[model samples]
Target chain A: MAKGIISWIDRRFPLTAIIKHELTEYPTPRNLSYWWNFGFLAGFVLVLQILTGIFLAMHYKPDASMAFDSLQTIMRDVNYGWLLRYLHSTGASAFFIVIYVHMARTLYYGSYRAPRELLWWTGQVLLLSIMASAFMGYLLPWGQMSYWGAGVITNLFGATPFIGEAVVLWLRGDFAVGDATLTRFFALHYLFPFLVAGMVVIHLVSLHTVKSSNPSGINLEDKDNIPFHPYYTSKDGFGLGVYLIIFCWFVFFAPNTFIEAVNNNPANPLVTPPHIVPEWYFLPFYAILRSIPDLLGGVVAMVMSLLLFAVLPFADRSTIPGGARYRPIYRVTFFLFIADIFVLGYLGAQAPTGYVVPMGQVATFLYFATFFILPIVSKREDKWLRARLPQELLAQFDRTNALAKGQNKGDAP
Target chain B: MSDSKSMDKPLDCPERRNFLEKATAVVGGVGVAGASWPFINSMNPSADVLENAISEVDLKVIEVGQSQTVSWEGKPVFVVHRTPAQIAAMQASKGGPDPQEDTARTQQPEWLVVVGLCTHLGCVPTRDNEGWLCPCHGSRYDNSGRILHGPAPANLPVPPYKIVSSETIIIGVA
Candidate 1:
């Protein structure tokens, strides 16, 4: 009887086949590490954000006058509103954490090379779209930080020529940040997640198109592959367990760790805060913005800093397909680049006066130089590597068969 | 490489076919534009949005030299009952930066009204003895809200206001 019903449904839709193809029977590389599970963790965070955000939106009032009070009401009055709000808020910070790790893993593994270029670009767009959604969502509370933060960001557009003033007025819907801005931001906040969800779909679609890149950075044969159902699905389940432990720690114990104390105060336009910094995730880009004294130039530099990731596939001229894993020189440069961003991010939170400005400029210079000069350095290094160890490259490119790799003399280790 | 199909219709030249294709595209474009009109129009200010679109301020209780701020459409509207000296000083001043007479800025000689934002970067300016001083970049506006000095390129904008009675004025409506 169950078989008959299953066949009836299967005739209409290839449910069993789809499950086998996409989930239960999907082939994945055998040597994937703990880092690979972050893709699933990011997806989990997205779902968490959407779920908590939907509930919070049901109670959120977008008026600047009432938004602050509404947040209090949600905390003090609504049933489980505090839980939903914290989940959504902390989920935002958690979202960035997972995504940053995911992107860094992509860079470290050279997943953006050649065939996965489109996949990587889609991810870059997804990152940008998610960043925009998070930025807009931050204003829903109508806190002092939210008000001035939104103002400074919108004011950045005033650097554009000709229709700058008109565009600014149109965005704010008033001469200054007020109810209209709040309402519009709320509407966009409600709208952007769905847009991001669409981008996520595209991102996943592009990812599935090329299949996943592995840490080994080599194409695995059927023998080196495992069905995703019993293997990766179990690994992913375990990863989710660890993620939830960390997530629940924040949700239960340290809910307000990522939130600022000043954000408790209502938005007041008459008084500008002592320091106007964006959320921690945006600090590096914010540093880039303040690094240049010229307004338009600053805007351009900040934009280029983000969009430079798109040029990564073309920028890499290395023959080492094993990514930074095998390339020692590139690996050192990669770590230095990460350190530079951390320094820039720290400088961004500080007042942009005195030594901070010059230091940020130096960091920013190094950040850009990382992408532009990597290809040149890799090309030169490839020559020396070819001279000393030409056999390594040949062995890496032409592995006879995965099952027979144990017998391969070059890979004796 | 030429096909025999072209020989059958000598009048159907490349230009004629191109014109037909272009004309069809233009018509389709117009149809799409027409279809999009309602969605575009719906985004304009609806009735609910227009609720806080105008604000009425009571002017009777405000005495001379006293200023009061009221929120209209989420912007601070400054209503100052000008002192005789300030009004006289404003009228005597021809043009410092923004080329506008005092009469043009005020509905009544005793009452001064303007949006309380700096023209330079949209910071709210603080009122002073002479006029208003922008705390951000130090742009100054005269009693008539004319740009007096600093980085401001234009005068503090006078919002469109309707004085229905001597005791009350409505802002944000022509």
Candidate 2:
């Protein structure tokens, strides 16, 4: 009887066919490393965030007067509320960790090359949407940092050339951050995650269209490919197990690691905190904004810093398939770029005084310089690497080079 | 017979079709914008918020050289009773970074009023012996709230306020 019912449903819908094609029998490169697990991990964190957030939102208030006390009620009064809140908070940090690692793996493997540009672009949009969600979410707690951070960030709109003050007033729903701003942000904060989920669907569709890029960066034959079900599902399950252990440790033991201490105090518009700092994730961009002298210029610089990531597909002109693996110069620059980001983040957290000022300016310069330098060096390095290729490898190198340029899509056995 | 056949024929008018297509797009665009207008305008400061914009502070209690903070439009307004020496110094020194006369920053020499938030990133500046110093980025302001040095491009903003009686000063009137 169950078999007959399944067949009836299968006739109406392609349910079984879709399950076989996408889940059970989907093909993936056999050589994929543990780095490939981050995409799965990011999806896991998103669901964790949504589930925890839904439960937390049930007991929390979004008003300026009640928000802080509501959170206190959740911590002290509600059963298991603290666990849900901590899990949600830590899940945000975990989400970024997973995404950054996923992006780094992509960069390292040259996964954002031709034929996958749309996939990379979709991922960029997802990053921006996630950032918007995080920014709005931070304000829901109605803490001192939340208040001032909203004030400062909304003031960024005041840098607009003509209608600056009006834009700022509209954004805050008043002359300063207050009740109206809080309610609207709370609504948007809840809304953005679903938008992010939709974007993730688009991202996956783009991904499945081009398929996964392996560490070697070469499009392999079907013989080298493995079904995603038994092979990758098991590997991903193991990775998720390891990630959860670390995530839960932070959630239970050190929940406040990602939360600012000043946020414990209720938001007071009259008093801005002595030393105001944004959440750790925003520090690098905040540092970039601070480094510039002009308000409008700083806002522009900070925005460009993010939008520039989209240019990576074009900036990297190297015909080589495997990124950094076969190229020495690209590898060195990649590490330098990471170090520069660390410096910027560190400076962003400190008072903008003494050595921090000059250091920040220098680091900000280096950040942009890294992008500008890539295109020039990549073309030269490709030529240099080609000249050094052995006779036997030259014909094979030429074939792969054309493939990397996206001349063909046939990855058949 | 030819006239009857011509009457039955369909007219292939490219210009008319093109105009209709453009007209439909424009009307649809206007409808979408009209539908979005309310949602966009909903974010602006509401009637209730605008109603409470005006705040009154009794200036009778504040002593010379002391400053009082009053909330207006949800922002801190610094009301300082300037000392004789402080007024003299500001009058003599040319206001910097953003140059304005000490007379311009104040309505009366003794009563100096400016918004407490930093002109740069909006952090509230703390009062000091010389002037108010912004703690976040180290932007210094003189007694008249003129920008002295640091990343701040302008002086502390003067809000629209009025002194109604000798003792009563109302903020946010303008």
* Highest lDDT model number: 2
RMSD, model 2, all Cα superposed?
2.2
Model 1 chain A: worst 10 consecutive residues (lDDT sum): A400-409
Q: List the residue pairs that clash in candidate 2.
A: none
Q: What is the C-alpha lDDT of each candidate?
A: 0.82, 0.90
True contacts kept of 1: 0.12
Clashes of 1: 0
What candidate 2 gets wrong by more than 4 Å, as runs, is A404-413, B1-10
**Candidate 2 structure quality by residue, lDDT tens digits, A1-413:** 99898899999998889889887888999999999999999999999899999999999999988999999999889999899889988888888889989988888777887768889899999999999998999998889999999999999998999999899999989888999999999999999999999999999988888788888867788899999999999999999999999998999999999999999999998888899899888999999999998999999999999999899989999877768888898888888988899999999999998899889999999999988999999999988987887766767756776765544456543
Pairs of residues at least 3 apart in sequence or in different chains that clash in candidate 1? none
- TM-score of each prediction: 0.80, 0.97
The prediction achieving the highest DockQ against the true structure is 2
Q: All models, DockQ values?
A: 0.18, 0.85
Model 1 earns a TM-score of 0.80
